[model samples]
Target: MSQIVAAIDLRVVQLEKQGVTGMALANQMMGHMADLQMIYNTASDRDLRKLCQRFPGFGRYAMLMEEVSEQNQTMAMSGTHPYGDLPDLPEPLKTALVHVLRAAADLERDFQATADDGRGDNQGRLTTARWRWADDLEKLIYQFQSAELPLQTQALVQQIIKATAERIGRMG
Candidate 1:
């Protein structure tokens, strides 16, 4: 699990360096972080302590993941909107964003279902959905880059992409 997580983390870093940013990047990060959390949860106490000592960032990332999980729980309980104050994006971009968001929601639902089942029967479905979401998001980002949007819109898109990449860097 640790090796798998490390490989995924490295891939994400490489992708970010290549200017890939969006739901796909975020989803990949979240997936590996969850796997890391599972490792900690299932490890013996002494092993967990040793892991923390050997890899200081492990503990910090775990805490960060916990905080994020708690915040997500709170937001879900509060029934708050997942996306707030969406910008006035142009036609296909706006449509693409909507599709990506829906795919994200579906991925989350499948992940939770798999977790609840514990047998991981839904693993294939989750993987397929994740890849599809990633592909769609990649297309959207490419479209945003190629389309002739207003200066403000382009700047806003760039800001979003930069922020996401920075956040992922901090996490890794």
Candidate 2:
């Protein structure tokens, strides 16, 4: 399970790096984003930890992964960061931001759906997932506007924001 989780995470990192490097969006781009959220859910908990004594090998790596995950969470929360230093990009490249934003939204929805059902899931995981999505969305909006992003990118961002707002409106 951990190995599969690691593979998904690596794919997410690769996609992110590829986008930053101005790679063309391939057919698997959307599927890759969905897989990332799925992996996050899979590796995030350890109900079996309390059942067994330390399995030495798994214990060590789990601890290491937990720490790495914490650091990534921290970076995601710190609003003024990560992709801030990117150079001015063309319409095609900047449009890729939509994928990042959509992935965040998908993660939030996935977590919230589980959390709301109260199906013996960890509340902390759900709360943190939602917070991460909200914080990252805000940061993405700031970064998108701060840069001289192309008109097409601006339009895409606007559409996402509008759609999200409408969804929220319906809930109320």
Candidate 3:
């Protein structure tokens, strides 16, 4: 007997190999990322500055997500993106991409929350700085939601995943 394959079947294949779905992977990835965040948040100003300077494009997607002008000279921009188009990625990658995006937003929110609770400088400067970054994160999240990529066709989802991979690869 012969078998039939569909677009969704690849997702199952990926699950069998990875042993974790998109959301779970997203959570795990974010957990690791959170550790980095803690380090960044705790290090001395000089060390933290160095870290930021070294890994400046840690969240380069935040710029594309926020739709910042690629040519803007003021904003510290990474080089041009190669993931300008989407490809036919497996379902697991697509779902994981969305969840990972959510994770990024969550981290941003976590930072914002700390500021809101007066955990930083009592003089409000630290809180203000946190808010400044938080607002940018929020805008990225909002942009994803507005794009409605999840509900769109598989092609669009693939495009996002491809773009994501490209940006991520460029990070290191």
Runs in model 3 lying further than 4 Å from the true structure = 1-81, 84-86, 120-172
* Clash totals in order: 0, 0, 1
Which structure among the candidates has the greatest lDDT?
A: 1
Candidate 2: give the clashing pairs: none
The residue-by-residue lDDT of candidate 2 on 1-172, one tens digit each, is 4543343344333434445212222222232444444544654345336311233323333344455456657776785445434445556444545555455445534443454566746556655755665676677677768768656657755675656544433322
Off by over 4 Å in 2: 1-99, 105-109, 112-120, 164-172
Candidate 1 residue 7 Cα shift, in angstroms, is: 32
Q: Please give, for residues 52-144, the per-residue lDDT of candidate 1 as tens digits.
A: 565544554455566667777787678773532345677778667656654554454345445555777777867776777768868878998
> Local distance difference test, per candidate?
0.58, 0.47, 0.39
Q: Which stretches of candidate 1 lie over 4 Å from their true place?
A: 1-87, 150-172
Shift of residue 164 alpha carbon in model 1, Å: 8.7
Between 1 and 3, whose lDDT is larger? 1
* Alpha-carbon RMSD, each predicted model: 13.4, 14.1, 18.9
Give TM per candidate. Answer: 0.40, 0.37, 0.23
- Tens-digit lDDT track for model 3 on 1-172? 0011111122223323456444443332332333344454566767645544544333222222224333333343453433333344456444445455444333333443444565654436434544554464445445555553534444554454344334333321
